[model samples]
Target: MNHHHNPPIHHHTTTTQILKQSTTILINSNHLSTFFLLSFLIFSLRLNVETATHSLTSFIDHDPSIKSLLNRLHLPPSSSNHHSPRVKKPFLQLTRVGTLDDDDFFSGDENPDHRFFDTARNIKKNQTLLFFDCFDHLGFVNYSDNGVRVPELVPSNGKVEFKLSESVGIDEKIDADDIYSENVNEGVEDFLKRFELEHHEMSALLFLLGVLSASYGFAILGFVVTYAWVLGIVFVVVVNDLLKGYKSFVRTLWDGSNLGLKRLSGFIVMRWAIRDALTQLLGVWFFGEIEDQYLFFKIFVRLKLMPFSIVSPWVNGVEKEIYGFLLSWILLDTLVSFVFAVDAWIAMADTRKSVREVVKEGCHLLSLMLHPAINLKLLEGIVCGSFARWVLAGLFGKLFASAFQSFMEVYFMVTWLLYYFSVKSKDANASGVPFGQRELERLLEDVR
Candidate 1:
């Protein structure tokens, strides 16, 4: 009998190790300033969304003392067997006493939060609590629909029973023309003339289009094609930007009356791109969905690499969320930004020479492909960017939402340039090339 025992798996510890190692590589690789600019421009929307979301959710106010006092008075539960909670608290009570017709029920007050908030007084025992304002008149009440007839709400034999349906007393004002104007643009001129409204509302309509473009468009493609869809989007958006940058680059390369493919590694660039996408997909899976108020971004910046905690303190409440984001961003996302900064400077110094050097470096890229963990971290930035594009764009603005998406396009090429140079520089150092003088001169000659 063969007694070959397979080793047991250690999942948690192994995952932890991988995360730590990946984090370290993210910090050590170059391009910090660029990452911070991208992160700040992009993640700020998420930060605001996080804060507003918290503020919105906190509108539900609960008074335990009042509940306990009522309990001591032996108040009977609204229903026998007490399956659903019917013991209404004082804060949830509504102010109006008179019976409301369906018209009154359908036509709710314009300012429910300000008027009906804590101002609601004594609740009737026979009456059911349908609407409530908990946070000092702030809007945090939930009104559910029960489908009961309107006449049923009138007191019957001193016993008032009302099962709440999602009926609120207020009707929201919506511009029908604004919604319909997209597919039918002619309606807008009439709408503006009819409503006596300004073009400011047009901004909102345009923003609405952006929302549809990002979400509807992304949902159709992002899920159906996955990675390939992301690639297509990046390609479409950055092709112009890359061409603009590449113009000066080409002029510098061919200025000497010679054009050579050896000066650029087409195969190497393609390989890196494919590998980078795979690494990015892995990073997205590793990081998972960022469900908790920018929690993933928060944890990444505070590590030894970024050190954002020095300027910011870790406070409790919502402020802690921001601090965590700053701290976490420094370690995980800064490397590529630093790499971009170096590449930009190098390109600016000598576009032609930089191209040749990068091609030379690209040939040796395989030798330095040992740090996929770092690429995983870089991919996380794109994930955050995607959230900005699809989720926050509607909440914020289209331009703001598109910032990171735009950054990712520019960033991929920049990082490629940096990666080649970093490896080539390392190899050059091994060959007794002075790290500070030789590479620095090549990188900064245009500056001089």
Candidate 2:
């Protein structure tokens, strides 16, 4: 047997190192003025949507007929002052149901800080509260629920007493919308008439649509400008400008006027548009199927207590299913992004390569991005960013979501660009040749 030693293929850079480097480079090259400009434009456009939505919501909330209709449909209450309650705060006192041992004592009962949270009126008396000790990673509460309470300033108390209304039975469940309901017997159409926009509201709606269109147009233009600026910074840093990367984006925007080939790296934008269109089509098809399946799954889960149900016992609600759908969507987006990242850079770097060739190489080299370590980290980052966007949108509405998305967009671009660079460097090193020489030889071979 021939004895031979094979060297281990070691990647010098870790995902963390790449992330840190990308962050530093992006911060150095980022233009806050452009970001703020885009944000302001988005904010201005979203203001229209917000106003329109708020106007519609307020109309529905304050209108007795509409409120009655909604109540008949068993929908949740609106977050408007039309149904705001003016109840006095309830008296709270702690009570210990069991005696404490000699070794067990309240450490600091005197002048102890106490806190109380008001729960919804629908809360039943015997409902279970699942508690976890996160600090120790304990799965569930360590103590029993029977004898847990305190008094005015007790520190080591575990139970509380609420001065609830005697009218509410222990097992009685309340509907939050009951107070907002009216005695009207109007039909849906009769109530919908209340939503007919006034002259001013109509004007606002029209203006909103106009502003929304303008915002989208500006967004497309902004995309081109951002690509130009990023390419400029990249070229300036890399000392390569063959694609006229140093050209002023303003002149290109002003002269070419439209999204034409005359603009700097306009073809890449065209590629992106096509890719995005296809991706969106894929999403529509995928999500349509997913929605149908999700509906079926949701119904199946809800019917778990019925005869011959197939769903697992733990699959009680649609929450976990929705998470699964979201995760699948993110994976799809990440994979699509992997291909587009390479394709975009190829289009920017070399116009000589046809679109077909660029796409072919992009798809071919996607395996590089799929390297276990790198892809997992990339997926984690995407998940974090997406989760943050969802949460911010829910809690604070459109403004914060728009701003966060804008920042993440550029940050991810820089990250993928750095990743491409790292992959190229690794390829060059593995081949034991300079990058330019390897490219030249490949081109010559292709020509042959």
Candidate 3:
């Protein structure tokens, strides 16, 4: 009755559980610093563009002529206005991207009761009225809908006619032919010159200095981040070349050309570099263009390519445009990912395979991308992170937002690269052999 129970034995598995595999890869000390440096360079360059634009726009907003025009037009301030109170305002002037408010008002589609027309009629003869509704600027219109009211600002009395040039019609598209007269163009050019802000040579020189700093910073980052990969790729190509030459004399002669023997790795790196540069350029250009609400309301309109409208009770045209642009980018990203997978297969996996075979093999990876669990994880990390970053920028400042953006960029790049590697490994395992690495090992064995 005095027997003591033996202490329970615990089993320990050799394989450690990775809490979040992607996060583990991202935080690796070897990669973290390089990622942050790259992010800093990117953010700094974008900040330059935003700074230049903000400087120009701030000048326009504070101009007496522009202020007078806005006041006389009775247009409300932009909902997305970036102005700060006097005490909090920076002496050197810091600003956010876009910062301009859009103008919209009564629309033909929404005013079935002629309320807009009635309101316009009541206004005095000399005053100009801007009329609109949400649907007017939305680009999708039901021409036959009974709810549509033709926007006519002329009052009942002949003496109170409002000229077309004076009235701001939100829905009207300006025809080039109508405004092409030299006299009209000259007058418009003269008007714009008054609002244009000129930069001193000193400011231009300073901007050039900032760009050079970013370039140097990026180059330094490349040494740590890209140099290893470049060397590895070159080594792989050289090993492959040596193996082919040892295998057959006829093939060795032909394969020299096939191996892309002339600056092979350099060409590969250059191509990828160009692709990356274009992608960044396009993204920055789009961000700058889309944030301009003044340009959107005055010059641009929705493309009408969407099958159905994304109607929201509270969302304005600018918000809708942002959504549209985001959706477009998502689609473009997916297509680019697929193309990248194919390119990766050709470059790293097997150059001898037919295009169709490569594509067929790569299709297996699509399942991974479309997996519900993975999709949810991506949404949580990317979409939520983006929203949070934007909110933090609004609440705190750009520094916090820039940090978040850099982190997110690292996450995005690591996630996709890992996905590619995982898919490739799985494919090799299914085929009952290692592929790329195994070949390299065999080449080493032959050399030995």
Question: What is the C-alpha local distance difference test score of each model?
Answer: 0.33, 0.40, 0.38
For all the candidates, what are their Cα RMSDs to the real structure? 21.9, 24.4, 19.5
Model 3, 58: alpha-carbon shift in Å?
4.5
Worst 10 residues of 2 by lDDT: 304-313
Comparing 1 with 2 on lDDT, the higher-scoring candidate is 2
Number of colliding residue pairs in each model: 29, 4, 6
For model 2, the stretches where C-alpha displacement exceeds 4 angstroms are 1-12, 27-329, 363-373, 376-385, 394-397, 436-448
TM-score of each: 0.23, 0.40, 0.37
Better candidate number, 2 or 3, judged by lDDT:
2
lDDT of 3: 0.38
Top candidate, metric lDDT: 2
> How do the residues 1-448 of candidate 1 rate in per-residue lDDT, one tens digit apiece?
1112321111112223434533432243232333334334324433433343333222211323322322232222333345753332221111122111232211222322112122122224323332222232222234233343333222212232344244432243222243233313433443333223356544543453354345323332322232222222222222222222222333332321121122213322433343333333333433333333223222221111111111122323446445445445444335534333233223333346555574443434434543542553356454544344657678778556555554454345334433434454555446755433233334323312
Clashing residue pairs, backbone N/CA/C < 3 A, model 3: 78-101, 105-132, 106-132, 106-133, 107-132, 107-133
TM-score of 1: 0.23
